[model samples]
Target chain A: MSRRPSPSSSTAVPAARYLIGIDGGGTGTRARLVDSAGRRLGQGEAGPSALGQGVDQAWRNIRQAIDAAFLAAGLTPAAEADCALGLGLAGAEVATRRERFLASAPAYCKLALATDAATTLAGAHAGRPGTIVAVGTGTIGLARHADGRETSANGWGFPVGDEGSGAWLGLLAMQIAQQAFDGRSAAGALARAVWRTAGGSRAELLAWCEHAGQQRYAELAPLVFETEADDTQAAALLAAAAQAIEATVVAIDPRAELPLALCGSLGRRLEPYLDAATRARCVKPAGDAIDGALQLVREQIRQPLAPGIP
Target chain B: MSRRPSPSSSTAVPAARYLIGIDGGGTGTRARLVDSAGRRLGQGEAGPSALGQGVDQAWRNIRQAIDAAFLAAGLTPAAEADCALGLGLAGAEVATRRERFLASAPAYCKLALATDAATTLAGAHAGRPGTIVAVGTGTIGLARHADGRETSANGWGFPVGDEGSGAWLGLLAMQIAQQAFDGRSAAGALARAVWRTAGGSRAELLAWCEHAGQQRYAELAPLVFETEADDTQAAALLAAAAQAIEATVVAIDPRAELPLALCGSLGRRLEPYLDAATRARCVKPAGDAIDGALQLVREQIRQPLAPGIP
Candidate 1:
């Protein structure tokens, strides 16, 4: 039986000089490489590594991103034993998959795992106490209190939750497009734009729906923003999404004391739509999730691996 | 090269004494068997036969339902040549799939195909000139005019269209349940019921969403009705559904001159929720889609096969 090398033994190796931070999500996996002093070396990206997709695929994507980062850094790809890895991954909140991922860790000198939300929060606050609402194709709100207590709200996956995310807006847009196609509702500019983009006929719309996944639906989100000014449907959907974002933030930080940051493609766009009080509390994130992942790695290197991590 | 047997030639067979009416939907395929005189012989049900599911699977499910009906009739399962078939199928509105289905017909004596909406209207009006709104797991409205002209509205499939459908209501309920699970929203009676039914935890809900399809979403629709009285979310959903039904009926028959019938599992339940004007036009259906499929077969037996139908 193979036993994990003890942390002290692994750290004794002379070549263990690099730290790799991974931000893995449904859309893509990104890796940032830094040295012992936290100097940024390079960054690279690969396909989605969301744990829900499959453990093998996730690992493959992470490896691909890491290798790219090494290549960009003008260094040969290092063996697992030469690096420490910190992974902030979507779907890592699910215990079974997360456990499988941790248990199957390669021969890295040291490693740590956390949900992408945690990494985003860490990055947003520069590893301090703060709140961040990450709203890209999906939505999640996380807060780290001054005392280090952490809380999260509304990060459910597409077509069900993920309110105020790109998927949420896209879903409402598609429904409006269907109503337009059936003539049950007036075809507003947003609906017309969606229909035009989706092939412009009921049959075409039907075909699109038959094959549509979260990504496909998310592709329609731009039309919602584009037509919001002239389309009541689009405006209503945005308002609802904005309201959800507000609700999410309030749930994560009820006292509104934490420095709040809105992150992701959709997050900044939603800032203008938030209520006065919430908007006043919002701040730009100090760093991205990659920065947070690097911070995570730095923390792990400074301390012993958490109990049972090996 | 093989050619379809001409309708005239196939009709000459003496064994063609039965008519089979098939209502093939996403949830299930149902078959109603009748003698030459239009007297009901038996009914049978099988798995989903929605054309969108794949023609081969749809055909297999339809055949299974027909076989079960034959067995229930206390008759030896007759060869395909002994039966004339009429199919009212969901997803038959897609021209490519419909054509493929028609082109691949088996050795039946004669056959007719129509959208489930058209067949439901036919059955509801009993071959008369009227309109019917079908509100089962999906929703559609069809109107048959006095001059034999027909029109339809809605009936788009789940997650995109199908407004006011069981799937629509259920999707909303699940979203509410997700919000409730995250403590982002209060767990109202409807949300609590859905959570209880879906295994009562965020993990269970996540698992459910991971594997959920249209059928699974439709399964939660009952909870909406079950808790509507005490749940604001349920009441709001039903009201939206009722408004959708009203909009569909108006779209199908704008003048409201035709007698209107509500049909399907959720149809009658929506009656009390309809606007007063739309409710005033509602009538009990004379028969269900099976009866219309039977009528369709009887008409085909009397008239020559329509052009372009092999």
Candidate 2:
């Protein structure tokens, strides 16, 4: 049996108004210690700590980041004990992994774990009922209602379905290169640019791509974007990306009444791509994922929703 | 004067003896030396020599490959200078480039440069004269008549077009990835595999893709093929590729009789993606692009075209 550490054993967080919020993403983990009055006392950041990676790694990352924050504030790690904690983690939707994470994370006075998206959505809506569509390394459209109802669409990984994502744009550029190679058509400068951008030769590009262990293909999307005006192929690819995102939003809810918030790297970049028609349909939210995490903690403190939000 | 070597400088070849055919592709240049006996004597390969790349590079690659073939066959490069040469160049259709290549290359007793697809079609029809649709890195449908007339369709470069080519497959795969990322829909294992195959992590993949010296991304298409069955998104992407090719063929001549010879790697690998209806209209060519090149050279030897074939 795994022994659960007793919160009472620690001499941290005697303050009744202590609170904490964490944002665990694919790239890294971040945590902030705040007070009941919404004053931020400490903040921390650490390495890549997505839960899908595994609980041990996630915990370690979060622990390191949180520890840094505490150290910076001239406090002990145990000071987190006085806080009500909220964690918005990537891949928290996977029930089994979530359970494992919840079971293993070091003790806090009170804790809640949810998807990174949820926190992002909460932040964007400032804990109000609204929808948030995020497009980062991938894409996803998520919504939460004032009545606590929720709906989600898309978020398929890269390559096969990232919509207007960088991966999607890069893939389109690849197709252009393939066409150029087949002698069916001329890709003009775009093909040359892509090959040159990847590496000097096809062999080197393939080798580097295999060895890099990064979604390197997605990186090529920027070149396509940069050359769009001069290269029709690039322009068309971008248009297709925009259209794909529009499709996702339409799928989520055809009506424009729902408050739709956009977040994530790609999401921020897609503003120009969004047609006037799509822009008219979505209401911009007020906050970001971080804000949402804080709101969730505050709400939980006010009224805990344990068995789940019905 | 860029040293325009006179075509008349070389010794003439016997009317029914040998022919030289070249397939100038993106990666490198390939030339085949065939005799009237239908035997392949010398096959040479060299670095990128696409006419679009530049006349100097093209000439250098072609000459290297041709020289290698001559060396392998115990013949001097100068000895075959009199043989008629048929060049199927990736960028031969571009008027300016074609003329430049013709002026630059070592003078054969007779020579002609045509679009690479022309060679594929001629070879597929075995020089008899018929419609041949070649689907590979790109897609093109060509109709040839015994009277020497030709009509072509659908080889536009991607992402706007290229129909049923590798470019098309790559483009579709990218769109799917984007769609998946955007939360428009769910993509299966294929997207994941594609992401994994393209360097693993987001940053690594991005770096490898965007680096100016990296290799081309088309080399990674095999990953999609490997995971096609297990990944629905990939299967769909491949299906789109086959459909694009079939569409290109249909656009060529709706009622044309097909003995549609297929070309290109994807043409062979994703054959199953072609529907039965499309397959019935397909043809397997007896010869390859090299044969077509041979036929072109032989024609130049017997009766040079009005000097406009290039």
Candidate 3:
């Protein structure tokens, strides 16, 4: 079933000399390199490699990070044929993007790929079934069950979804600021902070917002945190975000069996705002998405998916 | 004081032989042609002329409609020097855009310009001081008082504001549909309809939403109303919409004293859901935005703004 069996694989025993685990998202990509025995060798970071953004860009970033990782290990960059790689990337859930990404990959001893949320869960729980809510520029909750079935909550993307994400927080802040501008609400600390960041005048705000996307909106999220103490409306928004997180947790793991991990750009920041019950379910992550990617690659090397089956 | 004082202005009294009133919004533009005596002549409609969309496109559509209006009047298209014009155009509140739009004008006998909301208010009360809540692709409340001071609420634009608007309803429905897809909520009628319109598959949804704007979101609004009877969530969304409308009304007219008229693509449709007390202030509009523009032009012809002051 192999079109290009490795020269080393002809003996029927695998000869992978390297293992690399990669975590990629909207902001950046991280690669962790290890020996065949799973001992850490080197680590590298590169620019954003979210698959949906562009498969070519994703691969380029991944390759750059991989090269850096090998250099950090004090070796010439290893050949793709000698490496087994696992990638947990943002936007990999979109089947078409993932396929295009996979098709363009360099032939390796083995490869495994999944959405960043999936790998986050795997890494957080040390390969066991668990739940993870990642809230950054976007937000989503994912759970892996004992039955190997997976469920997810939120993570609906830009201006429409991502309920408790940084973008969501920023959008809510803007709503309040707009109402303030119209004199429908008080121009409180939150409104002032938001207006200052976006612009002060109606014309300025409209122009700034006209072409803004998720990242632009998320840039405003921090203002909410900074002004919450002095702005009741800001505090209310945080409370709502906390509620949205709790709801997502409940949705993903109704029985609360899976240990929950809230980790992303915004997730950990929101931890204190979460109610005690939801916080109680939260556990320290055993490892990160990179470690999960390592675990996934190890498994894939043991049992490779057939060529052309991805 | 106009740079191009009408040839007729030199006659000691304004001698414009014809008048035109234009109402322009996101979806289309309408031009109403009337005689110098203010008698109805003819009317014509054309493509969208919202200034925010594009100044060139707005002018092109306005000119097309104006030409059609003149033809419908069974007269040769009048020269710019012979026609006084009034325009109520969307996005006229953005000072810079309004400036750009006015700067590109054709130099008619006399020109009067205001936001569509202002002209709607002027028209709804037959040029008197009153309140109008116009809800279509977007929502806003505007009230002109006897003292000439004006108050407005909402209409904060898309993705963040314009609460209770068609776009808002569509956005809320899409939010629910996303949760349903993620197993966070039941797929009620609203969700099903939205998913169908947006594409049911996750990949399809993501691809569709990747580039959607305010108009794209507004396209899904009718589904909320269509499914309200079968979906409690849809009903609740409508109830929330009605509440938003009421809040705007109360925000603009806190004393509840002004005669309120609900007229727009969605304004009257949401009326039945308003509270009885709020509905008690409802009044039929005296005329449409075109009439208000006509009235505004009449005033401008009587006393022109100083040149370069717009």
Candidate 4:
């Protein structure tokens, strides 16, 4: 529901001209509603929205965020059919999970779905055709062709891959921590910081390799970077991380001369660490994914899908 | 307990002129008894010898190994009173646990204790003044001076620092496995081998990390290396491991060209991967750690520990 005048229930059947865009992620789900004028009518947010974990959890959060926005805008629940939803969900790349999400679709005016990376691309180009490289807890390269073709590379989970990602950096930190603990490698303050941060006794640490977790490991990565000011191992790990990032870029469209966007929280945080060549390879996007979603929604209302978006 | 009669014992009351060497490690514990003539009297083996995890189990294994050697030579347990034990144990590196082991000292005629690394050094140069760079499940460089001054580097632990050891290699393999799973890396057969070896389910693997233990990790190292034939990630890991080994050597005694004695199962397996310069830098011992322990026992029997050994 929006603060605007109600047209859905009127006998005249006035057309509703607005769309809702959502960026569904592990941390939280964010929703923005915009009309044909490109003005935001309402915005909302809620908890974890990774679809692969489960659809119930994902939609629950999405609905919560949307409901909050609608309530604040003084709209009634009866206005639900006046809006279309465009969702960019994390972990939607899996075929089975995507199918399950499509099957359980809400009875909105219209709904469309795509992977988080694809949304990131749409965001990068403001719904236009371009490529985006996201470096968060994981790494992924995605591109949109003018002819509607899409391609992707690298976005593996941590341990073996996830180049230039939080997981990659975290794995390297673990290596240095082990060396310092055993007296094989010298870490000085870095070792003490890691021990304090990781929260385990020496005996417990002796058994750390056997019982480590993703969150526990992910927690140590920032500490490694923090210690890079003086610790050799930490410094080396950072350098290695930087190299991995560069390699990922090279792997994707080796000659990225056109507009290329760097997306994700990690990309922003590690921007300074990126080499000159890699930096030169990127171009700032005109608008983000949410803006792209808004633009998508507004266009659909003005000139509805030719064949009704099959 | 020697099948061959000892010349010294022939004098009726046996003068203890021989020594027993015990090398207790994660895989197993081994004992060797040698006479004054540098001749082997008997030898024995048993399992789970690390003190911290299994004191009762370790003692049980030790007693079995020792008893078997004597029985094999048709000797009575009463003869145990005439033997001195020179023990080098794995968990001796842990301060509290080592102290506990020392407090519960087994009933032997006489004994001296140190880390398995220390005993390995004693075996390498027959307790003479020299350096030993040990590469096993972990890597450690130890140097003993004439005045008993000792210096060590590396052997930090796996997932932190182990550098060029089995645990180091195994952890690297896991990183590749994770990468392959995410599609950010391609590990081919090596990835499948690890999945099979580590238990097929990712959730099971996640759980395994909570308490996988050292032996489980050490066992997977060979599989990592075997995958190098076709897996890019495995090859990269091996190359990185080789570089780490070189870095460890440099950290040990950069200036002095000391005799580097490489030992351990991993060291033997990675001989081909090590660079020619690093190979030339090493002085490959003629025997393994157990043989070295046996040699030390034989030498000590021939010429007692020149006063200071006690």
TM-score of 4: 0.60
Q: Candidate 4 docking category? A: incorrect
Instruction: Report the C-alpha lDDT of model 1 over A1-310, residue by residue, as the tens digit.
Output: 5454466654533355889999999889999998877788998899999999999889999999999999999999988988989889999989999988877778888787898999999999899999999999999999999898988889878777889999888878988887776667788999899889887877788788878878888889999999999998899998998999999988888888998999999999889998999999988899998888878876766655444563
The lDDT for every candidate, in the order shown, is 0.86, 0.68, 0.89, 0.67
Q: What's the CA error at residue A302 for candidate 1, in Å?
A: 1.7
Selected candidate, larger DockQ, 1 vs 3: 1
Worst window of 10 by summed lDDT in candidate 2 chain A: A5-14
True-vs-predicted CA distance for residue B2, candidate 1, Å: 29
Please give the ranking of all candidate structures by TM-score, highest first, separated by commas. Answer: 1, 3, 4, 2
DockQ of all predictions against the true structure, Cα-based: 0.68, 0.12, 0.65, 0.20
- For candidate 3, write residues A1-310 as lDDT tens digits: 5465453343443578999999999889999999989999999989999987799999999999999999899989988989988999999988888889989999887788988888888899998889999989999998999999998888879889999999999999988988888777789999999888889987777777776778999999999999999999999999999989998998999998888999887999999999998999899889999998999987766654444664
Scored against the native two-chain complex, candidate 3 gets a DockQ of: 0.65
True contacts kept of 2: 0.23
Query: Over 4 Å off in model 4, which ranges?
Result: A1-160, A166-239, A249-265, A275-310, B1-20, B33-39, B51-57, B67-84, B103-111, B170-243, B255-257, B269-281, B284-288, B291-310
Candidate 2 residue-wise lDDT at B282: 64
How big is the positional error of residue A299 in model 4, measured in Å on the Cα after superposition?
18
- 10 residues in a row with least lDDT, candidate 1 chain A: A7-16
Q: Highest lDDT: which candidate? A: 3
Per residue, candidate 4 scores C-alpha lDDT tens digits across A1-310 of 4233233323323345657888887678888876646577788889977786798898889888888667656665336577777788887776667788878877777676777777778878877667777877777777776767665666644443466777667756766555565445666666777677654464666656445644456666787778888787777766766666665555444556445788877776676777887777677777666665655554444444333234
